[model samples]
Structure formats: C-alpha cells, structure tokens
Target: MQSNHKKRICIVTRSLSEGGADRVASLQSILLNNLGYQVFIVTILNSVSYPYKGELFNLGAIKEKNDTILGRFNRLLLLRKFLKSKKIDIVVDHRVRKKPFSEYIISALVYPKKTIYVVHNHAIDLYFPPFKWLTKLVYKKSKAIVSVSGKIQNLIFKKYGFRHLETIYNPVDLDYIDKQKIESVTIESPYVFWYGRFEDEQKNLSLLVDSYNDSKLKSQGVKLVLMGNGKDKDKILSKVGELGLTDTIVVLPFSSNPFPYIFNSKFTVLSSRFEGFPMTVLESLACGIPVVSVRYDNYEDGVLKHKHNGVLVENHNSGALAKGLNLLVGDEKLYLSCCENARKSIESFSMEAIALQWKNLIEK
Candidate 1:
C-alpha cells in the first residue's frame, strides 16, 4: 500500500495462448499495467496468441530448442535468475504444478515469499500434487493460494487443510470487451456459440454436438457455431456429419478476439465436465450474451444464476443439456430477459473491482 514501494509484479504461467487460465493471466497483465504497475510475464511455453501489456520471458523457446535433461535444468536456473534480475515484487503463478519434484525446486529456490498460486480447475491435483505433505510443504510458504471458485476453495481446504486459500472469480475485462465486441464479423445467420479447445474429455465436445442435434434450435434455423482446436476436432466433425447436422453446425478455429462473434450470437453454451470459472462464461455475460451451461458438482456457484442471468442445466447429461438449449431458445421472453440482465449481472466481476482485490491482497 505504500506509494514508495515499487509495484513490480510478474506473472508466471504456461503461455499467453488459448486457455481460460492463460487468458486470465493475460488480462491480469493488462489490468496491472493500467494501474501503473511495472508488469512482466514469464511464459513457460513459447506459444502466445492473446494480447498482453507487459514484457514476456518465453522459457519455452529454450526448451523447444533443446529438450534434454541438461536443457531442463538450465531452464530452471535461468527462471530463477530472470525473476531475481527483474526484482519482481510479487509473483502470480498460474502454471499447473503437476510434477512434485519440479514444484519442490521452484518453491524452495525459485519463487519468493510474495508468490500467489492460482488454481483454475476443480481437479485439485493438477495444481497441488496428490501428496498432501508435499503440497503443504511447497505451497504453505506462499503469500496465498487463490481459487477461481468457492467450490475449489473448499475442495482445497478439505483435501489439503490449507487455511491461506481464497476464492477470486475470473474478472471480465469490460473495457477490452467493449473494444473487441464492435469488430465486424461476416457471419450472417443467428447462431448459438461455444468456443474452447476441441478436447472431448474436459470440454465434452460430443455433448455439445449431440445436444445441438437434439435441440430445436437447428430446426428453427438457428445455427450452432463452435470455435476452437484440439485432438477431437475430427471426431466431433464426424459425429456432426453422421447426424446430418454438419451444415447446421459450424466449426471454426480459435480466435484471439472472439467477442465480435459472441456479441452477435443468440446465446452461448458451455458443456464442460468441470471448470474453475470459465472465461467464456464471464466473457459471454460481459458481451450481453446469456449462457446455458451444464452444471458440474459444486461448480457454477457464484458465476451462473439459474434463470436470472443464464440457465443452468440441472445435469450434465446430453438430454438435460438439450432440454436447456430448447428452453432458452424456445421461450422468447426468457431469452430476452436473460440477455438484458447478462451484462449487469457480471458488473461485480469487472477488471477494476477484481483488481482492487488483488491490490488489497498484495498490500495486506
């Protein structure tokens, strides 16, 4: 909180590319930069598609060139030296800490006491390894562990008994959305949208296809637009073709600026098996587009309101999701009401409000 103290913060994550957690890191860089902080980003991977306002240190380039054991060790040494050279005041780490030994080294040698680990999924082991003692040993020394949902916060506590954990939902970058939403798109037909990787396990891409096939939206001439890339693209396309809904279902690659498409869509849908707090859902609501998402256990608590802002399908089954799609698109009055309430529903999650929480956390 002291003005005399330099606000030099650096974010450590996988990449500033296509992923919900990665996108949040990119937004944080912009938010911190706008607040007059000296911001820097250190991406473990070289992939970068999202726009960010900070200097980037791409460690992935080194690993790409030489992926030997010696090269990996060198990357670790260089990461530590890079942080020290920048004299980073705070480190907001968004990387998935899967390997226990690597995390131990990073926690013991690389990161400082001001580091904050952000958990972005319900799969707690992805962020904290399965070993409870090791998880506590590495993470307990940090400033705090932040989860994007209250459910994840509780899971962390119940699983690991960490008292320093807190929940900070993903903030929607309204200013950025305002600028991006106005970009022109060539799509003519009104479509329901879903954008993310084509992975079938986590994102449940087949559920999206099956539900769309069963929904009346296609019969009523509302198209389904899917935007993203992954391993299951061919499988998803094949399923769509088999169902004879290929023409009705439009599949496109991921877009860095997807707001224009989202802004013009009738609504958005999320069928993910689980998520911490998806950026797409927040971005959809921020774009004044209501979302119809399949609810996962203990998730969607704060973000999705059942009928006020969006429809939360009671179950993850394809039939339930199909019914939800029909209800939201079938009932004109409900659809319009949700659309009208969408933007305001997420006002509390604006970048400024969430940034204030980050500022408080850093100062306190």
Candidate 2:
C-alpha cells in the first residue's frame, strides 16, 4: 500500500546558469518545493546562480579536489548508491547531452526507470551523425519524455517514432518577477532590450547586432542593450566595435532581476536561430514589453503570435529584420497596441499554470 505522505522527487541539472533550461530546472524545483513535495536538486556542478527552496546536493563538492581514477569511480558509485538508498520517487533529467554514450551509460546504471527527460532544444539539429540515432534510443530508457515546446515534440515523434510525448512550455516565475522590485540598475533611456547567452551560433546575436546597425533606430538615441555573458562575448563585442556600434550598442552581464529593464524599455528584441520555446520572449511578455524577433522555426508555434502581441520577421536577413524592428518600434500606434495586449498573450505560461501541468505529470 502507498503511504499517505509527500512523494520524494529529484531534479537533476548540469548547473544553474543564465540558460533558459537552467532557469526552468531551478524554477521547477522551487515550485515543487513550495507545492509541499519532498524536493531535492542534484546539480553536477557547484555554480548555482538561482535560489531554490529545496535541499541541494552539489556532487562536485563531494569529490576530492585532486582527480584520481579511484576517486572518480568512488564518486560515481556514491551517487548511484545515494539515490538508490533515498528511493527517490522520480528523477527529472534536464541536462541536454551532446553525446549519447555517457548519457546512455548513466541512465542504464543510475536511472534505469522513473526518469523523465526534458528536451530543451531543436533536438534534431543539435546532434550530429549516428549519435543522433543513438541519442533517441537512449531516451527510451526514461519513464517519459517531455518537450519544452510542441514543435520539439513533433520533431521527436517524426524522427524517432516515439508514441507518447508531452509538450510543457517553460514556466515563468510570475510572483518573483512581479514582487521583486528592482530599485537599482535602471536603464533611463527608452531602449530596445535583448538579453540572452552571447553565443552566436544558436542565439544568432551577430544578426541582431548587424540588424540593429543597419536600422536608423540607433540614430534616435534609443540604445540597444544586450545582456548575458558567454564564451562568445569577446567575439560578439569585437564585432559590435567593428561595425562602429560600440557607443550605440551596450553589453551587460546577466542581471538577477531584469524585469525593470524589460518593463521600461520601448520593446524587447530577439534573433535566435531556434529555441525550445524561448523563455526570453515569455518573460518579456510577462513584463508587459512588446517583442520583436526573427520567425525562427519554433517561433510561430509558441510565445510569438505575430502582430497580435509581437512582430515576427519573415526571414533572418539583416535588412528584413531591420525593417521589421523599425516598423514595430517606430510606429507609435502599433507599439502601443502590442504593449496593451502583451501580458494577456502569455497567461497560459504563468508559473502556477505550468506547475499544475508538471504536478499532473508527476502524480500520474
């Protein structure tokens, strides 16, 4: 007979960073903890940026400072033994694996069952060659598969022939964004904001900078502030300088609370190559800022409803994006219309709403 008590749950993440998935992982743990579940966050690394309301286990901290063969094996064994002993009801796996071998091995050993893999990308393109096939096979070991957006679920079904999959959009902690008033780090200028990891390949920041440069918006003294740091920061920054846009464009490190900037800006912008569902767009809407973004593949399927709430460029061309940006921000009536209807568009993605979905999945 099942005990009438809180079910123990664990969320496994690589680390907490500015990445959309990282935010989702930490937010889920906090939500579940608040929902009165026995929650645990098992992070592979110690660099946690977000605060959570559950027990946190930093696997990195337990291992010896010096890397010895035996020490590494012992740590792995310890992790497996610990989880087994605790008898976790479920393990929510949120790490995106670039390679299949290690993930498959770990799942077979530590997560043989009762594990749910949360896919957070345009899954098919993120992999290479035969490993993609192997990765799909590895996912079979999980108790269930969840896609961050419906588009990802469709891709997985078509490619891997998976029968069942759940599409759960990333949740926005509305209470935190609403109540955490930021009195500091205010952007006085009426600017168009863009914030995300500085990585260019997937995020397509190069296109955003070029499009911003191509547009005459910068001439109006409406600054373009790009937030979040990554390995590609210096390269993107150098490009910003090369295009003679250092003064017009600004790059800032990720802020713990970016709502004030989003709420005050003329509108927010994005130019991602692809996204699992785009937390930035959802967060931007939650803050009541109209969005302007390229119509990446998954863009249409989620967050962006075009013209209704935000402007969507037809293609990724700089000229097209520039024209779209100028149209959205330059036209007073259109921007006002979008801003008025912004928050209403994403009410379904509120933290509480998404948490209900997760709760249903967990209890099922």
Model 2 compared with the native: what TM-score? 0.92
Measured against the true structure, the TM-scores of the candidates, in listed sequence, are 0.96, 0.92
Quality of model 2 by C-alpha lDDT: 0.79
lDDT of 1 at 362: 76
**Total clashes for model 1:** 0
Per-candidate clash tally = 0, 0
Off by over 4 Å in 2: 1-5, 62-75, 125-137
Indicate which candidate wins on lDDT. Answer: 1
RMSD of each: 1.7, 2.8
Query: 114-193, model 1: which lDDT tens digit per residue?
Result: 89999999887889766788778878889999998888898989988888887888888898899999989767768999
lDDT by residue (1-364, candidate 2, tens digit) is 1223487888888777678887889899877876778887887766678767678777767653635767766766766876777778889888765555555667778773788888888855443224656766766666778888788888888887776588888988777887653444556676899987888888889898889999979878888988898889999999998999888887889876677788778889988887878888888898888899898867757777778788989665899899988998788888889988998888888777887788878777
User: Would you list the clashing residue pairs of candidate 2?
Assistant: none
